[model samples]
Target: MPEVKSQVDPSDASPFTRVRQLAQRAGLDGFLLALLGAILLAYLWPHFGSDDGPLPLNQIANYGVSIIFFFYGLRLSPEKLKAGLSNWRLHLVVQTTTFLVFPLLLIAARPFFDTGNQKLLWLGGFYLAALPSTVSSSVVMVSIAGGNLPAAIFNASISSLLGVFVTPIWMALYLPNGGHNSSLWGTIGNLALQVLLPVVVGVLLHRWLSAWAKRYDKQTRYLDQSIILLIVYTSFCESFYRGIFQGYQLTSILLLGVLLLALFFGVYAWILLVSKVLGFEKGDTITALFCGSKKSLVQGTVMSKVLFPDARLAGIVLLPLMMYHALQILIASIIAQAIGRRAAPEVPVPEPVAGT
Candidate 1:
């Protein structure tokens, strides 16, 4: 007689288990949080419009981001940077793609965008290209895939440092000077303050507080993501409030979303292939593909205040940045799963051992 096995059904007994199973099945509880935040924004926005009612939650969220960045600074360590510098070549490739190759692609695509809602969207795409690679997400993805975490931390930090200069140069070359946009010097100052300053402070205190950072990593991480999701919701709210999305047909925006998605994944696939061709091991390849393809939403928004100013196009300028941020997280999470499985192969058992 064959033995029988029973499987547990989460739905039958506990509601808690059922929700957990559902979230796992759909993948990305963070994304679900982000989506929920967006829904809340849509619901509460109308009430917040009046002067007496209350301050807009979006503005509250932006303030939260500033605080988040300060804590982000507190958490970064010099050790991570030093270790990443040891494998400078791997970091170099990722930085080159993020700063150099990506900008070239965006520039090349400009002619195609010359007609039809292309100009604004092109600026958005260029903004996406110019921004730095992500730190937290890159490290998270690498860790999840069982890849090199220290290298991810190093490369991601270095990329952020490089963006302080590189992103402005790209913007100056691509965006014609408007009367309101900040000069290059002002942009640099803003970058120094908003990005470099906090990170530097974090590094300076690393020796004293690194252990605490490790212990509280999970809590800080949740706050970090919540802040980003808030930023996204607020950005979209501003765009929606300003009638930016309304000006364009719903179908057209949907089409652009698909196009942007293709562009994102296309570059991701290309990098994965290139990393393999360049003789990177599976772990390094995973790092390169993810770190290379990501753009930093936090940097873009912080810069937008100085670069674009309190202008009508601010929200529109950031539309591509928003789309790219969400897309990278969703797509990379999926790819990381696949790469992790491949990298950790299952060995076959010898059948003769049983007979012996």
Candidate 2:
């Protein structure tokens, strides 16, 4: 006789189990959930990192950012980056989108906002466009989506380096009289010492430490996210204390959110079209889509201190970027999971013998 078999009913599963299954399916994992919590905490306790606050959160965040990039550089394989560089077409597309397409889009939208406050807000949007793709999140999302990881790493790293010069030139076009005293060379020097030096050190040590770095990849990711949260908290704190957010009306804020969403999807769609036109493989396409769509909050926050000079307007300038950062993560997480699922190989089950 055939062996008896039992099947569990879906209805019999506990509510907690069902909810967990749904969340897993939807990619709403703990990290994404914690991001929402981080925003709430920032809103509730923005004063902690204010200009006259009890803590030195900004200084701590600056150090943390360097460490984050150091680990990032440690994980990157020099051989992989060199090999990936041969894919010049992919590199051209991703970089062009980051440095050219994004800024052009925002510039085209300038005529829509003519008033003083509107122009400031528009400048915030333009600033977001001028920035480079994020390092950690861009690579993370592309890997999660089964993209060309090496190319993703190469493009993201180069984008950050390029932004050191490119972003300032873009800002100078419109912010000529913003009263910032620092020269562009001074800004570059600051970035080279704080951001570039640590990266070079990590790269030099990568051969000896690569295995250990891979071993603790998950922990490093958590550390990266923690540092980002710290930065967000301090940035929002400065904004909250200065009433920077209050300068905008509710309708305008909502519209800005909508515009950011549109910008994300618009770039994503353009990348998809371009990748198809170039006849890219699935992995390369995924890398291009993710890297092209993201803007770097890390670069933005660091550059803001140097570029804005004025503490009050710096917070306001950061607002659009903050919103874009959160939205990109949320949207990209969902999309990456969907692509991962689609790319996943189907497991073949064994067939039963005739007389088992």
Tens-digit lDDT string for candidate 1 (56-155): 6555654564565566667766666676677766787898889988888888778877754668878888888888888777777776676777778888
Candidate 2 global CA lDDT score: 0.78
Residue 65 CA error for candidate 1 (Å)? 5.1
Query: How many angstroms is residue 227 displaced in model 1 relative to the true structure, after the best TM-score fit?
Result: 3.9
Give the lDDT of residue 174 in candidate 2: 74
Candidate 1 local accuracy as lDDT? Answer: 0.68
Give the TM-scores of the predictions, in the order they appear. 0.80, 0.81
Q: Number of the top candidate by lDDT?
A: 2
Q: In model 2, which regions exceed 4 Å deviation?
A: 1-35, 136-147, 175-182, 301-309, 333-356
* Residue-wise C-alpha lDDT for candidate 2, range 1-356, written one tens digit per residue: 99989998978999998996666444455654565566567668877776678988777877886786688678767887787778899999999999999999999999999987788789899999999998777887787788998898899888877887788878777773636435666556666776778778888999999899999988987787777667656766777777767767989988999999999999999999999999999999999999999998767866675567555566668778877876787688778867776877352211110000
- Tell me the deviation in Å of residue 318 in model 2: 3.1
Could you give the C-alpha RMSD of every candidate to the true structure, in order shown? 7.3, 6.9
